[model samples]
Target: MDVLITGANRGIGAGLVAGYRARGAAVIAAARSGGDVALDVTDAACVAAMARALAGRAIGLLVCNAGVYVDKGERLEDGFAPALWAETFAVNVTGVFLTVQALLPNLSLAEAPKIAIVSSQMGSNMRANGGSYAYRASKAAATNLGRNLAKDLAPRGIAVGIYHPGWVRTDMGGAGADIALEESVAGLMARFDALDMARTGEFLAWDGREFPF
Candidate 1:
């Protein structure tokens, strides 16, 4: 299977690249820098160029994993700047849409293409805590994008699933996070493998539990 993962230079994205490669899948690790393919998801031209580079290849899986948490510790009083919101949404939400749009043709060539969006539990309305407003809102938008794409692409034999990869110990998740990177990667791979038309548009966790919207 040909799998392409964005933001694959580090953290969960890097682990996913290794995991898929270990399974013998033809993995295209795409990142803004230092990856198999140079792609900045926020840049439409870059995304288009990447698509052109892989013109005739069938992509069995497209992982929209590129995202930012710029407002991680911003204060409610004076934090969450306008620029931060724009940057976060550009990468977390718009980036996903652009990548999917640019790669639709490649995905259609596959027998059963799947799109895995690495959203977050913090995006869930039911699980809304407090801080990281921009990150939370962007993730929610990403999940919504994935859900709508699932409905639109079902006829094309493409399944889309939104996932929360758990509180993994990565730069984004922090060292005090709940699970190790390997554990999260293993569970996420299983989730991606289990995705199909019947389960499309569902919000799920790394461990396979349903995540409330």
Candidate 2:
């Protein structure tokens, strides 16, 4: 399979690139910097340029993994500034939309295209922990976007799946997080491999459990 992954320089993204390569997939590892394709997902022009550059390449899988968690530990009193919210949402929400929109043609070239959105369980209203408001809200929006995209793309033979990649030991997830990068990557690959029209619009955990929105 040919896969295009964003935010693929490090953390879960990097691990995913390695895992897919090991499995013999042709991987296009895109990043904001230091990758096969340097792309600022937040920039519409940049996204469009990348898409045009890769116009005919068939992308069987598109993983929208670029995201920011700028308000991780910020308190509502003084932290979680307006600028931070905007920055986080730009990357976490708008970035995903732009990437998918720009790559639609490439995706259409494949026999069965799939989109995996690395959203978070924290986005679920049932899982609210009352902190990291910006991250939570942005992820929630991403999940919603993925669901709607699934509906719209189904007739076109493109499936969309949203997932929480677990609390991994990445730069954003921290060392104290529950799972290792390998574990999350492995689970996510499984989920991606199993993705199809029947499972489109499903919000799932990396381990293959269905998640509540």
Candidate 3:
């Protein structure tokens, strides 16, 4: 299996890339910082060019994991960096849209393609709260985008799935999260192995349980 992970230079995205690579799966790691496919998820033209650059290659998995936070869980207009909110969504939501649009053609060449939009429970409309307003809103949009994509791509045999990585201990998730990075990612990959059209379009937790939208 050949896998592609956006934001592969750090955090869960990095772990996913490493996890797949360790399994001997051919991995195409994409990141704004460092990866085999260097890309800024927000740039449509760059995304398209990257996809074309990978043309004719097998891409069995696409981990749409690139995202951003509004620095300190703060929202613009009420915060110092007024532009932070838009920048957050640009990378977190719109970026996912353009990246996938760019990669779909390349992905169609795969035999059993899967697209996992690594999401979060902060996106849960049923559980919405006050903190991290910009981050929460963008992820919620990304999750919905994944749901719609599942429907649109079903005809092409591409399964689109969403996930909540939980309050992971990462640069963005702060230092107090409960689960270890390895544990969360391991559980999610196990779920990935069992997925098909039957279970696509669902929001899943890193532990493989379904999250209520």
Candidate 4:
């Protein structure tokens, strides 16, 4: 299988690249810098070029993992700057849409292509605990994008699933987070394997539990 993962320079994205390759899949690790494929998901021209580069190859899986969390400690009164919101949404929301849009043709060539969007439980309205407004809103948008894409792509034999990879010990998740990077990667791989048309558009956690929208 040909699997492409974005934001693969570090953290869960990097672990996923290693895990998928160990399973013998041809993995394309794409990052803003220092990856098998040089890609800045926020750049439309870069995304288009990537699509052209992989012109005829079939992509069995497309992992929209690129994201940002700039509002980590921003207070509601004066924290979430306008630029921060724009930057976060550009990468976390718009980037996912552009990548999927550019790669639709490649996904269509596969027998059963799947799209795995690495959203967060923090995005869930039911789980909202306040703070990180920009990150939360962007993730919610990402999940929504994945859900809609699942509907539009189902007829093309593509399955789209939004996932919360758990509170993993990564740069974004922090060292005090709940799980290790390997654990998150393992569970997420299983989730990806189980994805099909019947389960498309579902928001799930790394452990296979349903995530409330």
Identify the runs in model 4 with alpha carbons over 4 angstroms from their true place: none
Ranked by TM-score, the better of candidates 1 and 3 is 1
lDDT of 2: 0.94
The per-prediction CA RMSD against the true structure, in angstroms, equals: 0.6, 0.6, 1.5, 0.6
Report the CA-based lDDT of candidate 4 relative to the real structure: 0.94
Estimated TM-score for each candidate: 0.99, 0.99, 0.95, 0.99
Rate residue 104 of model 1 by lDDT.
Answer: 99
Tell me the tens digit of each residue's lDDT in model 2 across 18-103: 99999899999999897789899999989988998898999999999998888978988889888999999999999999999999
Q: In model 4, what lDDT does residue 189 have?
A: 97
TM-score of 1: 0.99
lDDT of each: 0.95, 0.94, 0.86, 0.94
What C-alpha lDDT, on a 0 to 100 scale, does residue 70 get in candidate 1? 92
lDDT of 4 at 92: 97
Which ranges in model 1 have alpha carbons more than 4 Å from their true place?
none
User: Least accurate stretch of 10 residues (summed lDDT) in model 3?
Assistant: 73-82
Question: Which scores greater on lDDT, model 1 or model 3?
Answer: 1
Instruction: For residue 8, give model 4's deviation from the true position in Å.
Output: 0.8
Q: Which ten contiguous residues of candidate 1 have the minimum total lDDT?
A: 64-73
